[model samples]
Target: MASSSTLSRRSLLKVGGGLGLLAAASQITPAWATGKGTKVSVNSPEQLLSLSAVDLSQAIRGGSVSCSEVMTAYLDQIETYNPTYNAIVSLRDREQLMDEASRADTELQRGQYRGWMHGFPHAVKDLAATKGLKTSLGSPILKDWVPGHDAIFVERLREAGAIIIGKTNTPEFGLGSQTYNSVFGVTRNAYNPDLCAGGSSGGAAVAIATGMVPVADGSDMMGSLRNPAAYNNIIGFRPSQGLVPFGPTKEVFYQQLGYEGPMGRTVQDTAMLLSTMAGYDSRVPLSQKSNPTSFAGNLDTNTQGLKVAWLGDFNGYLATEPGVLDVCEQALKHFNTIGGTVEAVDMKYPMEEVWQTWLTLRHFLIAGIASGLYSKESNRALMKPEAIWEIEGGLELSAMDVYKASKARTSWYHALDKLFDTYDVVALPSAQLFPFSADTHWPKEINGRTMDTYHRWMEVVTPGTLSGCPVANVPAGFDSQGRPMGIQLIGRNKEDLKVLKIAHAYEQAAKLTQTNPTLVKS
Candidate 1:
């Protein structure tokens, strides 16, 4: 598979002529020819900015549009608004992107169209390497780092005919949930520029929410993917760990917790991206042995008889906002309305223990990957203090610490297994609050509860993370401030598609997809 960056370059070269055509069209035709005219009235910058991946895919497939046209519109939007949001770290070669899009159009004309993602523009989080594109991982120490090859997931996306536009920003080493670093500054939320876009997949979510791209690839470990999706009011799906190849190491203990998946404006688009991204890779030893299935197929499957267990508070570790529970509860009621059984369930576990175990395991794993950066002679000014702290924490962890944490993770999984036996799905607030100001990291205090760590505030997601369950974030509703919130639908182990189907069902019933960010012109 070609690297996303290579594919992006090829695309720009292929479509350069077509982009010239678009430019000429604008010169000769009305302003609407540039998508600037009032075919639709945009309420805010966000409304005009966000575009659904599925919609863009359909437009290209129907011949009503061309990939170059779509890419150009998005590039224009990024140029006009991205400076204020800092969502897109670097852009792909535009002429290269247009060239690849033209090829997609040629293929369509030749009856060689790929599926949903063909000709669709997308981005990957900066932490994921892309050959020829800077993969800084949000750390200044590796500011000039470029990968020799694309990450396996990026390869899959290119094979599916998706054009990789560029990379989004993230926290240094993806250590925190807020998208900020000394390397690329910070990625602010599309809904409110002063607020955070959420991280370490923050840039990906913001790009999708702000119309810079239709679909984006993001990796989630400790809610990096889900939190950002929730903050930006987009759909983010974290497939069952081994379902999407996350390789170079097969250790189920850590690999299962950190995996890359898809984020988009709608459930169908997210599922489409997931389908393209799934499948086994020999490099990922624990990868499942099965042909990748279409995640978008039969998504209208009825949920009438399904049993959904609603664990609202996760035994009270999560501090949910006032309307957060209400929005999710109302969404759950829709399941009942559709003939599904909804019941409250008790999820009893040692919350503090889980956090500690996760911290120990995560810190050790991250430090191990960054061990080379911590040499005595170079650690002085090269590494961020937080990165140093995490590395030191990892070095202090004995083998016994890893063993104990793994054991705790196993215990937690078993507890969840018992719960899954009684429920077809588990649901909860995607985050504890509506989108907060992007200016700060997750609130140190919420509802009068002091969160000791950045990850503590998002403890609600750890159950699924620890269990390795496939989870999807469905846009639930907005808070009083008009910021979006979502509900997480977690499937039984390996039942990834089923969870997506349920999310699709809820999406159809709620019609909440109509809500989009109002982009303010800078």
Candidate 2:
């Protein structure tokens, strides 16, 4: 068993001096938050370290703390922790970041508040290109590749006054569930440095978990955002399809599965980040005209009479680890305290078909994006095996396969629509297992069941991705091993607001987010 300690409710609050910042900003209890029966305690730096992106925004905007203070605090924490965690990579341009922060402070002094993200120093996932910063996509071929312009999401973040500190690590081409590549190495869990921080948003999640960033930019296709958030004990949301639009793409309508979204330590902070991300542009046909501002507004915490369907194991079909299921089940009971009803719902579908559909569609998009890179000898040599497999799988897909997968995806959406007709939300374990060894590759099995592919272990999230439903991963608690665990709050198609509201209510009831992980320095 892993060595661990328990954090009392009083000590958890004392770490942050209060719970206001974490309460709404995607909050959770880190495994090491305990002050007694443990070797570690929350130190003074953690006080500022625990503030959510929303709290930091308010504090910086309101002049409670200078931008330089916020910038230096996170940079100090990152410098202290990143060497061990390997969450952020390609560090450079700090002098520029310091200058921008000072300018932001000057602007604030003149009563010019840009927005919620004003003057905040944060990093984008290496998968997202940023101008002048090294955006490696975790691939060796792009090791020194710097984009001349920001990706759409990065552009939006900058527009909202977010300072791009650097890029977070990711799997090569964002191809796997684990954060690793030939470039930067694997990113470890914030709770335990030896355990895996779920990826390809792994670096982004760890960065936010350890105060490297208050909020971050992460993209999700197959649980990239949600899985890492679950592992890191933070909040990750995969908004409804078309809610966040990208640019300079040739295939918008056909390939909309992969999307860039926000990551934060709190839902309110996540929502605030989403406000800058969500917008409609004719350049991307799939863009939704959602009022992103609504996401940042007051979250409804009252769960009076909300019906929740506890679909543990997808009707006993998913091979979830016993301990993980237990944690999720315990979290479901918290719904009752918030006036939410829980009932077992047997999803009457062959669960494996969802995985099949996702594999086909996901590979098709990947192959399309990786089209010409393989032709170059240097690039082919730099490509990771999983990435090559994905590209090949996409290329091997037949027209019939595409047609069948598209039909299956449509059917899956209808099936979820039917399920939502009966219940407001469906709850399940975010990841099948808690954080595993960061030193190892993907788990080959779950509960003794062998996984067939490198990504098969992450099949649990495929349905949500396939259905295009809005899903949020909220921290449930921790496994006996002191690793993080979380529950997924899934809403109906495009019911993004309702999804967040239910997650907020559960967050309030669970009170897990109130605790944060204290780095157990060796």
Candidate 3:
């Protein structure tokens, strides 16, 4: 499917510009606004929640269920469960969504159906600007700030006939994977509330996990997408950097690392979302031209003779919790059973250098985007300590440091290039640590080793983040305590379809996506 012509930054400003900001306060409030939905209740659309996006889309197209019915079901689910998980924040009035869905239903009745997302309820990452809705990006400084335009990807979703609902929580400015910010308190895991959901896509992941929302948009730089999917037992795909362009950014052509993509309960759903969120725009210089029609259309089920390598722990370079690797290793065995050869391969790259390069470049970008906040003590104080540290760390770095990091990044990609020549896909733990206490800021240490900072425990996702490769998270099952684990499926550069093909193969082989999280009865 071609991306909507409305996905340019110019289009964004025309719809909703991001300008309004609240006065500064050191003690910033979380952005989890509790807005009530329209009291219009329909018969339970609950069963529809069990269906995949592909099925739901077809059902809506075929008139098995009206768009209004599908949306009402999800709205009811959100109202009932959101208070429990705090995954959805800055929620829009349900009346607005119902109206949109009703219109969509009317359009379908008139044979004016849109695309796959014609009537689906979707929310982009809170970090993304939503035209009429408040987008705080989990930072209290931007609380009450409503954008006049939609982020490009968001507009793309809207044009596809998605009923834009609300925004999901994220770390302040999407800086961390933990998913907490001054604007939004911690988002809890679907399986266990005490544990973190994983972030900056944490809320999106949790929304999918808790049946709050079927599909959500997320950006992954340092595992923002994959880590949360692993923690919530869902699917998160980081498209090859330029395939799903940053849509809005200062430097588009050579962004060191970062991607905006889709996350959902199933890979097919993810592929469907990706098809809409992707396309080339000359406005985004780095955006690559490609027709994503085949992403969802050609989901090959055969993994016979695919070369899969499970690189557990980057040959012990990344600090990992004991059971995480075991979960991934077991996942590879499924590949082997499906006629795919899975083997453990030792990477011949300097792991420390890669980590350092990611940190240097990441903090550098964070520092620039957040520099305005640093100018004001109250705004800076509103940010988490790690965020301030990251800004300051970036400020302290010399051009030489960035150059060296870039050099390290080159070597790292080169090493992976060689590895990919031999392996079609590489599997690893999406995050080094399993879901941890939601109340806790970050894991201070893992496996008896001290983490350098709040997001240090998430280094396991760095490889894919830095490589600009297409990475998809597939459910690998749960741990001893029932916390979910996901294996990271890394395909060669821009091999987006190949990666999804194998992921679909694995999911079908194990029949894992059918499993759903059952919230504990209080």
Candidates in order have lDDT scores of 0.75, 0.79, 0.78
Q: Can you give the lDDT of residue 238 in candidate 3?
A: 94
State the displacement of the C-alpha of residue 300, model 1, in Å, after optimal TM-score superposition: 1.3
Worst 10 residues of 1 by lDDT: 16-25
Clashes of each: 27, 9, 12
What is the TM-score (0 to 1) of candidate 2? Answer: 0.90
CA lDDT, candidate 1, residue 44: 40
Question: Candidate 2 on 169-263: residue-level lDDT in tens?
Answer: 99988887889887877888899998999988999999988888888889999899899999998899998888888655667778778898888
Off by over 4 Å in 3: 1-44, 520-522
Q: What is the lDDT of candidate 2?
A: 0.79
- Return whichever of 1 and 3 wins on lDDT: 3
Q: How close is candidate 1 to the true structure, as a TM-score?
A: 0.86
